[model samples]
Target: MLRRSAYKNLQQRASQLQLKRSASQSVASIYFPSEPTAPVLKTESIPGPKSVELNEELGKVFDNRAAYFVSDYKQSIGNYLSDADGNKLLDVYAQISSIALGYNNPELLKTAKSDEMASAIINRPALACFPSAEYGQVLKDGILAAAPKGMNKVWTALSGSCANETAYKAAFMYQAQKKRGSLDFTHEELSSVMENKAPGASDSAILSFEKGFHGRLFGSLSTTRSKAIHKLDIPAFPWPAAPFPKLKYPLDNHKHENHAEEDRCLGELEKIIKNHPTDIAALIVEPVQSEGGDNHATPYFFQGVRDICTKYEILMIVDEVQTGVGASGKFWAHEHWNLTTPPDMVTFSKKFQAAGFYFKNPDLQPAQPYRQFNTWCGDPSKALIARTIYQEIEKYDLVNKTQEVGDILYKSLDTLLSKYPTKMKNLRGENFGTFIAWDFTSVLERQEFLDTCRQYGVNIGGCGDSSVRLRPTLAFGEEHAKLFLGIVEEIFLKLYK
Candidate 1:
């Protein structure tokens, strides 16, 4: 057995590697301290008395049926979520994969407490019309600093749906400009558009893949095919949906079959672009389809899609909302694709705190202002937090660290997967940092498993169909990985025997 010194050495190394500030430095740590070295379970069931009471009170005024438990953000710490009942759980879901650098990070707290952040929060600006004094520099230092290669300009939005919806607008406007070719809009065109008619409204569509998700807004909901609940009641536009590949795993074990499957999907994608009922304005896809079961595609598959979109003059939009900001090993997951030409637009949110779309074509900007206008275009407060988050990520090289931890997690998970093959299968995200997931036999089984994880003091989450996804914070290091694996091993044993 490894000696106690082994663990000591690990912690010692962690201290040495942590930010190197003087002991007397007045700056407070941005994130909360790592605590509950192991998860602390107090009750037989989650949502124990305190949580149930809070939810019941909340239900009197709002929807609380979906409430998992009442969270106590103040008590939560790195990779652990604290509930009102005082249960601190190893949190892998990480607020539906949004939290980066973990809760209450020291650097983030400092940035939050800074004069700059306070000003931005109290006196927010309409970024597009009257950007603040620090707006230009703030963007250059933060979001743009980590932008996917070849993207320079960014248009901030409110959420993932807004980002995607705006990107679709940009694509439609850009495509119209390319077709219009210096011609002024006719009087009939302008008036007809107000009535939502053909000529001025442009009858163009954004092409999305099957089993994909963009958002819940009208334009974006049409592109979202992951679930019916998010779209069932909403009146949707008739946008074209292309088939995405369904590859067999382990990928290496079924190489040729997977390649053939990708090719088949590519064929369908090309056909959809060429023969869609409406002109295809853009083709949007997730680098790793997060809401659609952590589905992944190969570089070859993406390149093929890019080629098809180019050939058909359809703009390519990579929806990196959940796959951006270093969660997927690289800063942007599409960075792993190595396309010969960059995507037309990249929509982002989740980990960045700030939400927006990056573009190279200035034509994507509407010919007139207020066409893509909103009250608060995007929050500068979130942008300030994003800047701090980006800087801290660089300071600690947290992306690379997450990637290293992911490798360890993957290997251990493979052993667990083997032990309970019937309970789980198609394990993925091997080299893609800590953005990992696996499939259960059924949706019920998967839901039960998540509940079981909660009983064991691990707040895990499920995704598209029957997948148990791992979307831990970037600060989920080797120690967290080991603890997670220990619980998982125990759960699998209990599940099987």
Candidate 2:
């Protein structure tokens, strides 16, 4: 017998499925039954009338420059995001890759309306101190269920940067504690620490790779080397930096050169760790550099880095903030590495809806109370939502489904790329799920392409200087992929001709 989804796909071959269609149809069928059939452009520009009016009103109190257009969340469904301008566009970026289940999913709406959700929202707890009685169950059912392999302990935080910062804190403290042999803080050390000085304030640094984008907070920002603009006004830690390998495109075609480049970067990493003046307490890296134009390094490079960290007695932190929760077709992208031992800590946020670090080292926990403490350690409401997301992913086998759909989508995009060689180059993320991207010749062309996609009723995104990245939700399937490729092809056809 054919699989359930295969049957569903076969049934959908009839015609374009409506938003309020049967449940056995594509995800779009159930989630957005009333969703707009296609793009409806009523104005000359996207930020037409209603969007401009709303932005003008909001500008009085907030920064509205970055507002692309006022989105109509209620009208958005499945893979399509709606703007106040009444344009229903296929959304591949998915709210900067934070959206997991797609726009205003019916299941999420149901969860939001539940009594548990209501109480959690109205009576938000200071999780560390007064966690709800159902906290353990919520965790076990949600975030814990999808914890990185070999990690049993978790420390929750507020955001991606906060998660990375907390993990860095844990690493620094763990290293210092190991060096101290005891927690006996000297008066001078305490006094020095009060003024942000060494010994107590931490002489250790979080070693980060160039082109890795961790976050914009102080500690995480120090680790973020992707863009200078994000770091221009921020004060960053004086930390040791390592080179992340710049792999060539059509990865299989340039295997030898890519392997050599990885080795070169590995050598640089070792040199940074061994020769840097400050001690390397921990090294943080992304499994795939999502914001750095979706740059990828081979498993061999990661393995070598792991070995180096082990030798140096430094902790390894896998920043899965943008890569975790089935984005790369793995529960955790590091699973693809096949490491003998798990990394010291794995920091996560974005798709998980909750933010935290997963760690196995008990000693990594500070010996003293109030060390890892924060006012609101985490949000129980998000944890509840995360729990539901986890359940739905399992029920639908979304990750595996994403893998299959990604293969189809990647092949399709590769074909489109071939047709426009001058506009598209360095196509990447072949087997790495739908976490794909391609570089344009110039930043202006890249920006224009994104704007044009909006006109064609597709909401896409860009990263680095001149690269378009695909960060569609796990729910994004063959149908959505076909729509995306159609729009992309139309644009390329218009531009190239």
Candidate 3:
């Protein structure tokens, strides 16, 4: 009888222990775990032997000159990137600012393995011609759900360049349609377009800023003025490049001068619009000029552009390909501007995975079909991924978290950079989430700093000549920020000493 009583008591304790274990494993706990305690440097040098060998082999068939190292993505977890050489890096670049969540996110993996995902991937739908029945529901639940304020529609495309190009097409067509009110295309117009001439082929131009980088395609490349290499040898459109405001840093100190500078640029922009020979259909600008060295302008400056565009009846296209999807403390970076009138169109890609333009006006869609048609209009698989990303972001409240973490990172860098003014200057993107950057005195210094950072197991990236830009994932937290800061400070000290 005593043995039976003891057995019953043991069974009750085991059941209690099982219940405790189940309670501890909540859904949230399964998703975001603590990041690596510190970076692990397994290789003496980055792009170690294995990486070099793979790149050497890859170069035989493809251009691998720009590859930092071939990544072992399967081994990469969270904010860490694993290279072919088995080096795990604290990745701040986040696949050139494309990764919304950290690597191998559990939620994303679950989505990836779903039956819906399998269908989308294997039977990729040509969205415009023969869209799948489920396409609308997918977009509605995913992409459209995360639309910027006032944006009601999106036209999906393949990449950032393609998204911008499509927006340009929409702009050109809209202007043409407006001009040809209640009119049909003439035989001359039809024939001339076939020959790639004016009247049928657009003589209208898209205006971009001096340091703006749009894309590498023919039309988009014309608007991309960041680097000569991106534009060289390609015949460009007769587009005008306006001056972007070059504001002084520590903005409070030089408020008057910066304000005057913005005025000067705004004045020049209007002058260019009035004087340009071709009709200025639209003007494209970045909230933060990313590739053009992380150049930034004030909300006042962006607002001025909006006012000018409004006055001229020109469309304003905010290119948020690099800055969108919660990176800049907002779903869309342009939201920070709080424009009196919403932009005519906004182009996006990178972090969103699905590339496209968002607009409120139905007029942006062409009057007839085939005008904006393409094969496999967009990958539905990517849309599925985008959907998962957006849902996870909303569920986790990552945008606000990014803002909180970004503030800590910016302040930490501000303190660190103060000690090495010459080595790092123009620390920008304060309060702009994890999208921060600082200018090095020279290209060599910048490269050296990046190389040294990598040696210390942090994979950062550079932009627009001599600037180090941080593009950490939305998952990058206070712990990750502290780790990054400590590594950077160590590098800076070693370099200076």
Candidate 1 vs candidate 3: which has greater lDDT? Answer: 3
- Model 1 agreement with the true structure over 1-497: per-residue lDDT tens digits: 22334334334543544423232211112243335456767666787889999999999999878889999998887677999989788899999999998876777888989999999999988877788988888999998897889989999999999999989988888888888889988898999999999798889988899889999988999999998888887898888888888988999999999899999999988777767777888999999888888898899999999998889888999999999998888989998899999999999999999999999888899898888888789999988888888998897787887788889999899987988787789999999998899999999999878887887788999889999999999887666777678777766766678
lDDT by residue for model 3 (51-142), tens: 99999999999988999998999888888899987777889999999998988888889989999999988888778888999999889999
RMSD after Cα superposition, model 3 = 9.2
TM-score for each of the candidates: 0.93, 0.94, 0.94
Tell me which residue pairs clash in candidate 2. 19-32, 19-33, 20-33
Candidate number with greatest lDDT: 3
Model 1: per-residue Cα lDDT at residue 296:
87
Selected candidate, larger lDDT, 1 vs 2 = 1
lDDT of all predictions: 0.85, 0.83, 0.87
Estimate the Cα RMSD of every predicted model relative to the unseen true structure.
Answer: 4.9, 5.2, 9.2
lDDT of 3: 0.87
Question: Compared with the true structure, what per-residue lDDT tens digits does model 2 show for residues 241-279?
Answer: 788889888888999999999999999889888788888
- In terms of TM-score, how similar is model 3 to the real structure? 0.94
